[model samples]
Target chain A: MSRYLAAVVLLAGLAHPAVGAAQAAQNATLRRAQQAYDNLEYRQVLTLARAALRERLTGAERARAYELLGFTYGAMDSILKAVDAFKQVVLLDPERQLDPNRVSPKAYSAFDVALRQVLLVRQLRVDSVSFVGGQGAVPVRFTVTQPARVVARAIGSGATVVIDSGAWNGQVNLRWPARLPGGDPVPAGTYTLVVDARLGQNTFSASQPIRVSHGRVDTLPSVTSLPGYQFLPETEIPPQSWRPVGLAFLYTGGALVGTLGLESSSLGSSSKRELGLVGGAALVTGFVMMLRKPAARPAQANILYNHLLRDQIARRNQDIAKENVARRQQVQVTVAPVSPVTPK
Target chain B: MTRAALGPLLLALALRPAAGQLVAVGPQFVLADYREVASGLRYRGNGFGGALWARRNRFSVEAAVVRLSFDPVAGSAADSGFTATQVDAWVAYDVAAYASIEVGVLHRSVDPEFDAQSVGALRVGARSFYQIGPGATVVFRANYLAAPKFSGGGHAAVSLDLGLGLDVRLAGRLHGTATYAFNRMNRRTNPGGTGEIDAPIQETVARLGLALGF
Candidate 1:
């Protein structure tokens, strides 16, 4: 009888009937915070959840409450503050074992965890790009931990606006095609590109400066003593270009033989008069040279022409003697007679 | 693409001691029509050819070749090769980068219709050469012909076929060609005088053609 009475007294002492009231108060606070959070009233919800947690409330519900507060701050553009709240959630649960269906372990649990790594974008600086290049408007974009819309601008032009799918940072960037719709090329100068973004109510901005160099990609800058052209010696020559050399020599040799034979033949003038044969062995040779299978022989001819052009000029000068003589004769004979040789 | 492309152009630039070259679409195309062999009348014809030359931004050379068949109206199937043949070649100087006048070999049997014939390289872009170069071509060339074989050398006189030619490509690979020629042909007779002639009938030819480069 004594032991039973002692047991009943101990049970009464150990049991605190007011504990249920405390728990009910905590549950009601959480429900209110969640309601405020769903309404996007982040500040109020954060305040409520923080107060409830401070009042000795613990467990997954508290963890979720902290997470909702982080989201609220994040949506409010208080990024650092949001990050801090999420960090606390991680530490509290160590292994991050939170009931996903209820809320989230991390204060900022994103839809895509694969993209959880924080993005710290550095400014894009164009050391130097040629203004004469075919493409314009080089694209430079950045991704951050949250949704953002970036506006890039140059010093003279208004911002080149771009909208990125903020969550995953996926975007379609456009650069000026070889020709712009406006028919004008972007000017060359020290240009500045500025990016402004406002995504999920949070805003961010950055600016990058670049210089537009004036010159052709293949042209050489006149440095003190170097050749005035940049050359990446052609790594490959089409079989059509070099192949003409061999065939040209062969055909040219044959042409030389035919030309010599026809030139030396007794059929020179008489044959020319009777048969109108003025050295016409060029057909076969030309055909052969041309049919040079259309691959490389023409290349040989151009090469030959380029190299021998100087000699050809000299030859042309020599050949012009006949024209000069004809002109002089026409002038002296006709003009002198018509003018009566006035003061000779 | 498809070799179905009408004209193929080759541009050559910068030559080494061995030769280095660059090609632009020079209007040039070669087309051969083989007689169905059953026409009982075999008419084989080859025509349309061109070439463009460059040492890059500095100098250029252009040329073309043309051949047309005369109806074979005068003989049997055996005379198809000898019935009527005309060819021309030429070169031009880039007096200005956009235009050139070529003075080369001209076949008397082709191209002399004067204004009616498109011998100017500028004609290359008109689909005249069936589409040659894609962007730009400038050509200049001259012509010269050799001994012409008339009647397969069967007691037929081998005569001189002289010519002056011109071709130009106003754009990348398109080109127009023309030829003024003095051609002479001799009738043939078998070795035993089956049918022979001592000299050939001489005629002048003026021909015009087109070429395209791919």
Candidate 2:
């Protein structure tokens, strides 16, 4: 009996060590999953956590495994699977809560969505925008998990104005009447849409960019048409003058007077009178005609108008180009719930 | 007076319109001198005339007619003088803007009651103009006149004349013109014979007028 007891003791000691090594290998899989998660190896965490949950595990160990699965799925953008994993964690340990700081709000919100599967909340996004007068109001659509105080703020450069706010529930569509709180038409430019939904102590917010656009966004001050007279260029030739003709006639009369004087000594009274009359009349007529001159007429003014018109057309094209760039640079943003929610 | 008549007819032909044409008409006064060598008589006269001139591109036409009565010196008989009528017509080709060559005719006749002489001649002439202003021009003309014999014992006469003229614009299409001319004529009587046939005469005339154009 002593010899048989000694052999069994030695065999039991060896079996105990072998059994510990097998259990240690199983525990190491869970530990390795946690280390992979910490190292941000999400694919490895998904594989190790799934394998650990398939095996027999304590409640705490199972909850930890599901937590790892939740974060891994969330990192991979599989929100439904993440929600399912987190919900399993809650079902396993009702007293445990997810640390808000450690996970993103998206993950927390998804978890809340799974917790309250009866009421679904969707992501906020712009629904539509209209630019015509009386239809300028922008519509924002969103679905809520429950009734909540929803506030939409339109933020602009140094100017924050609440565009819409009210108590609302279910799939709600809000209209931001295209005006500031001061009842002024919104100036054309860029703006930000901030949607805040508050239910009990929980508050959620979303930010989106919005813009207002119009064909005539800028005020074009009245452009006066160019004056016709200003564009006329000076001509090289001076206007016609009749002064030389008058001077010539005057000189001719002087010569005639001198001729009559030379002929007076030899002429009879009648002859002398005839010469005097002819020469005197010529002198008088010349003096009179010398004073008369015609007025100069103006040149054609339309030539200048043609040049100015071309320049004005070019400027107008540039103005149109500037307006086009301004219009295209505008982006209209509307914020509302766009994605449909489903329980995983 | 066939040549005299033809002068006006050719002038009328040169009136054919081309790119541009000018027409002028005017009242005129003429101072005339008359001398007779055989009689040793001298006279002076005054007359009135109408002048017409037209130009079409490089061509031109002109016509004038004057009537005058000469007065004798003191102690001279009333029958020693005569009343005369003169007509002139011409056609010219402008070789340049300011120069032209012309052909014309002149007819000078006395009233039968005055028992005076009648003469007809064909004329060839050259004229030059200097433009001083718009519508103002100074003119110089020289010509030779070939006169045919019309009386028994009379031979053909040749005459030369130098004329100075002025064209003064009064207003639109209205103008005044004045001219002074010196003429010398030589006549032969009884060709191939001689009996005081080489008669030379000198005449001077001054004219003033106003013209209208269309």
Per-candidate interface DockQ score: 0.01, 0.06
- State which candidate has the highest DockQ: 2
Q: Candidate 2: list runs displaced more than 4 Å.
A: A1-344, B1-21, B26-29, B75-78, B113-115, B131-136, B147-158, B169-174, B190-193
Provide the lDDT at A67 for model 1.
61
Model 2 residue B31 lDDT score: 85
Model 1 C-alpha lDDT per residue in residues B74-190, reported as the tens digit of each score? 332535343222334434444553444444443333222321111111111100111112121211122222333322333323433333333434344444444333333333435
lDDT by residue for model 1 over A230-309, one digit each (tens)?
32222223332322233333333333343334331211211222111111222332333343333211355455555465
Q: In candidate 1 chain B, where is summed lDDT lowest over 10 consecutive residues?
A: B123-132
DockQ score, prediction 2: 0.06
Query: Per-residue lDDT tens digits of candidate 2, residues A1-344?
Result: 99989645543332231232233444667777777766667789889989998888887678777877776677678999988987787556533455555456656666676655423234455654555333357776666556778887877774677867788776677777666556555666666777677877766565666765444334344344544524454233334454444544544444444344333222222233333444344444444444544323334555556566768866876787776676555434332333332112
Q: Model 1: chain B TM-score vs. truth? A: 0.34
TM-score of 1: 0.20
